[model samples]
Target: MADPTTPPEPNESVSETEIEAPRSRRRGILVAAVVAVVLIGLGVWWHSTYSEDTDDAQVNGHLIQVSSRIAGHVAKVYVDENQLVKAGDPIVDLDPSDYQVAVENAEAALASAKANAAAARVNVPIITINTGSNLRSADADVTGARATVAQAEEQLDAAKARVEQAEANNVKAQSDLERYKPLVEKDVISKQQFDAAVAAAASSKAALADSRASEQAAEDAIRVARERETQAQAMQKYAQTAPQQIAAQDAKAKQAEAQVEQAQAQLDQAKLNLGYTKIVAPADGIVTRKSVEIDQNVSSGQNLMTLVSLQDLWITANFKETQLRRMQAGQAVVVHIDSTGKDYSGRITQIGGATGSVLSLFPPENATGNYVKVVQRVPVRVDFTNLAKEDPNHQLRPGLSVEPKVRVK
Candidate 1:
């Protein structure tokens, strides 16, 4: 212990100490802590800002409805629920009885129509022949009528000549009778001669009457022949439409042919519908939602199930507005699925025009009293690059949560 008033002797190391030393040491430590905190903050900020992360997204694809196009009973269902299928795979079958009967009926109708068409075609020739014969017969009748007219004219000429000769003879007989009677009256002629002259006059008068009757008969024959000619002319006029009759038969044949074509078309349609009874798949896809059962009476336009195309899968990412500022169409993106920790590459195909809420059925109305400012999300469509060929797991499904990232330059 040293005296209280004396200054203590100091060691060299201890003498070098000042009040500022501890402060300096503390300041250096504070500086070093500040530097370390700044570095840590920078590292955390870099991690938060630049580190790649997965975003919440969904895998989507076309959900094609498989329905019956024709009405029938369910015959068979080839696929079950969640059964993977390819394109053009059969899924269901309907009772083909009705369609089969319809096809048969249509076929029979087509046959009948074809038969009728054939018959009509045959009738064309028959009508042609009949019409031609009628026309020829009419021509022959006209020729015969002209001959009869010539014969009647000749007969009328002969009758007129005979009447003229009979008249001259009768006039001469009358003149002789008158002269002879006057002689007899004078008692210069014998009674027998007077009697003979009177008989001759009577004979001449009878001959003239017979000749007039013959002329009247000839005129009547001429009128009868003229009437026959008129009838023949009318018949000829009717026969002039023989060509028209043939044409009409031909037109009937054409109409029958058209009917045959229509019937054939109907038969083809029926056969096609009958084939449709076997519900063959239109393309390669997976079977889903199989609601049809055996012996079920299904009708047309009924929903049987759905088919999801695995090959045509795409990812729909609902990114925030801030995240989408760098995203653009045709940009390459990586998809990380939550179900399977696998990465898939795709390209941005399209972007939704409106926010998800705006497209919702009951969208938020900004004019309402309970309106709140919320961050809107837009859908971005991403198409996988050959997922069906490369992905062995095929884990991507519709409505599955996934993470997507788009690279921007």
Candidate 2:
């Protein structure tokens, strides 16, 4: 509630003095401006003399997708996300029970096939022996039958001679009986003598009958011998088919061998499948995006993680198409990493066939209305040489922002 305006004293005027304050502040600001100008000028001169022409780029490498080759529950995961690994390192282990069972089954099948083959081989000799024995028996029977036929033929010849002799005796006996009867009627001889002659004649006639019966028996024996010989010949014919039997056995053996080979192939396939249970790193790299965990079930070819190979790294620079006029493969380049403030030496490796926008998921339709011309960007790949000598530990990685400069000359 004091008076709004009042006259100031000499002391108050002394406190409010602003004589050279604005001048001092202006001079300080001017000096700062001059120093900034000098630093900028020095920087421009240094860049023009030593710095290389650079374009915005990124570090790129092979992005390998790791997956399971067989279906099983993951028993163990040896690696974690973002972990570094070397080639042949085990990454995931699947339950090997199923594969082991398959291998065992295949092995059993192979053994069985081998046993069958061995058995078939043994049968070869057995069949040969049996066939040989049968043929020998048939041959012996044929020889015996031929001997019997010869013996029967000799007996028949003897019996025929005996029959002729008997017929002549019978003729003599009939003539003697007629003469004795006439003698008895004429009483020229005694009755006893005539009776004796008649008895002798009757006995001779009976002997003739017995000889005829012997000849008939000899003929029947010859027929029997011939029948026996025919039976032996038929048996010999059957025995002579040993070669055909051997051929059939050989075919069976061949079939068994083929089965063995087929089983062996299956065993090999099963072993290969078993090996798939242990998923290992394909190459030396850094692992990322590990999706598998212990006790997790995975199917064949399912994505498990990614491997970024650090052995080979390059830079992908999206340069304006106009800048490509002077760029070519094999040109030396300078790559500067913004993140680490490190410099790398490389060379141009490749150039894209089309612009970046043209390969985009949704490309710009220039035919549509409101088309605004834009400077197209072409991707250029710059590859590093002597990478192992530079960083053997693989410190450089993909997706790192870099500035790369190419020397046209």
Each candidate structure's count of clashing pairs: 5, 0
Estimate the lDDT of model 2.
Answer: 0.88
TM-score of 2: 0.62
Q: Which prediction has the highest TM-score against the true structure?
A: 1
The residue pairs found clashing in candidate 2 are none
Tell me the alpha-carbon RMSD of every candidate: 4.8, 11.9
The residue-by-residue lDDT of candidate 1 on 163-233, one tens digit each, is 88889889988998999988999988999999998888888888888888888888988998998999999
TM-score of 1: 0.75
Evaluated with lDDT, which candidate comes out highest? 2
Off by over 4 Å in 2: 1-57, 119-260, 318-328, 352-379
Model 1: residues with Cα > 4 Å off, grouped in runs: 1-56, 122-144, 150-154, 157-224, 231-239, 283-287, 321-326, 363-375
